[model samples]
Target: MRTLKAGALYFVLVFGAGFVLGSIRVPFLVPRLGARFAELLEMPVMLAVVFMAARYVIRRYALADRRTRLLMGTIALVLLASAELLLAFLMTGASPSAYVASRDPVSGSAFLAMLVLFAVLPALLPSGAVSDNPFKPKSVGGSDSFKR
Candidate 1:
């Protein structure tokens, strides 16, 4: 239902960003820096995308319940993994096991960690902090009371 929709949107946002970043990283960064360093460089950007996308999906869908958020994250992870494997199969004729085995060990481990973070982030994020401004001070009195 709502969780499904939220999950799909989250997957689209993060996956789309990754696809674009991969496009750049493969042809440009990989040759210059090597796979491990290129992938390591890309990790921080992907992490930011994951965090922002998770926050956006949770807030937009009103996914306040912990179970609901977890379900959404899981759904998104499944979709993302499936899409990646399918693309790898089509592009390189690599089986899933072969595809995984081919990854640079250091970069691959980081990628695995990112995947775990992606799966759990929605559930872990606080639901109450809906304010757009991160630095806005909490209000103490009537006139300055923070407004949603």
Candidate 2:
């Protein structure tokens, strides 16, 4: 289903981006970057998930109402955030893991930020926007492609 594929794409976007960023040493600001980059590392994942979810709604589902686009973004963010947190657990004991939850800061910060970001994303998606938008009408002749 389109939704499932979208979700998978979101996961890949988040996981892949995080992994890649995590592996690279910042060219200009290595130490300082390491201290602040976790959230930045998450930006692409968040944007990709939201954009895709919005596209999914517009194309396959009904994004006619603003509520729908927001819903899609919310769902995408939640799924991505869940995947991130799970990764955090898997990473807790690694070498630089102390940099993560050191004295519980990462835990507390991640929890708050993830929830706020995911919860607000949908509501913030721009309305009446399109760019070769996939959310356009799926059927040209007033027909549902999947129905017989």
Candidate 3:
């Protein structure tokens, strides 16, 4: 249940960002730079969103175990892909096969790689240090190791 909630939230966050970015990219960037360049330019921003969204979901949901994180990521990936295909069909009247075939090859390949990254990122990110002050370094051996 927790994993499901986390995964759904993750999907919403990343997909929402993509929707907004795509709105901008399609109208503004595509005309100016062309499809492939516009999509390439958008990739870094989407990557940042994916990283932050994955980290936030994992932490918010207390997804500590590797298996749980992996499951959550998998769920989000499936949802994201479905949503993309549905959106393409609705907006362009393209069948799933047509949509896939119409994608710019270079940008489409990059998008596929991003999808893989999005799926694995939750499990890949570190959970962070167990400290209130995350910047404070831990002593090597003993609590007094830093003292005079």
Candidate 4:
């Protein structure tokens, strides 16, 4: 249940951010930078959002372990990807293969790297580094609330 809740939050935040970036990318950036470059430009912004979202989820949930946090983030990314694909089909009526083939190799590879980073960011930091649990105060002995 905790994982589900955290994953949902991550998914919502990331997807919302993506929608805003996509809006800009499609019209403003794409025309000037072309589809691939526009996507690459959006990558850094989305990656920033992913880090913020991951931290938010970790702090909000007081996630205990790197494993659980990683799992939650991965689940969120999977859901976000699924949602994006669905939206693409609905908006453009493109089949999956066509959609995949439409991607510029460079931008697509960068996007995939970002997705992997999204899943791993939560675990990259030690557990207590991102959490503030009022109920589970840190001990002076250097024991972390997440150690359990």
In order of appearance, the predictions have TM-scores of 0.89, 0.48, 0.87, 0.85
* Candidate 2 lDDT tens digits, 45-146: 655654554454454443444565455555666676666667666766433345344524563475457556554554565554433455454445565665
How many backbone clashes are present in model 1? 0
Model 3 worst lDDT window (10 residues): 127-136
Of the candidates numbered 3 and 4, which has the greater lDDT value? 3
RMSD values for the candidates in order, in angstroms, are 3.6, 8.2, 3.2, 4.9
* Ranking of all candidate structures by their TM-score, best first: 1, 3, 4, 2
By summed lDDT, which 10 consecutive residues of candidate 1 come out lowest?
129-138
Q: Please, what is the whole-model Cα lDDT of each candidate in the order they appear?
A: 0.92, 0.52, 0.90, 0.85
Highest-TM-score candidate: 1
For residue 43, model 1's alpha carbon misses the true position, in angstroms, by 0.4
* lDDT tens per residue, model 3, 1-148: 9999999999999999999999999999999999999999999999999988987787677777877888999999999999999999999999999999999999999999999999998888775612344346756768676688
> Given candidate 1, what's the lDDT at residue 107?
96
Residue pairs clashing in model 2 are: 58-135, 59-135
Provide the lDDT at 96 for model 2: 37
Residue-by-residue lDDT tens digits, candidate 4, 8-74: 8999999999998898789898989799888987888898898888877888888879899888988
Whose lDDT is greatest here?
Answer: 1
- lDDT-best of 1 and 2: 1
Across residues 19-89, which tens digit of lDDT does each residue of candidate 1 receive?
99999999999999999999999999999999999988887777779889999999999999999999999
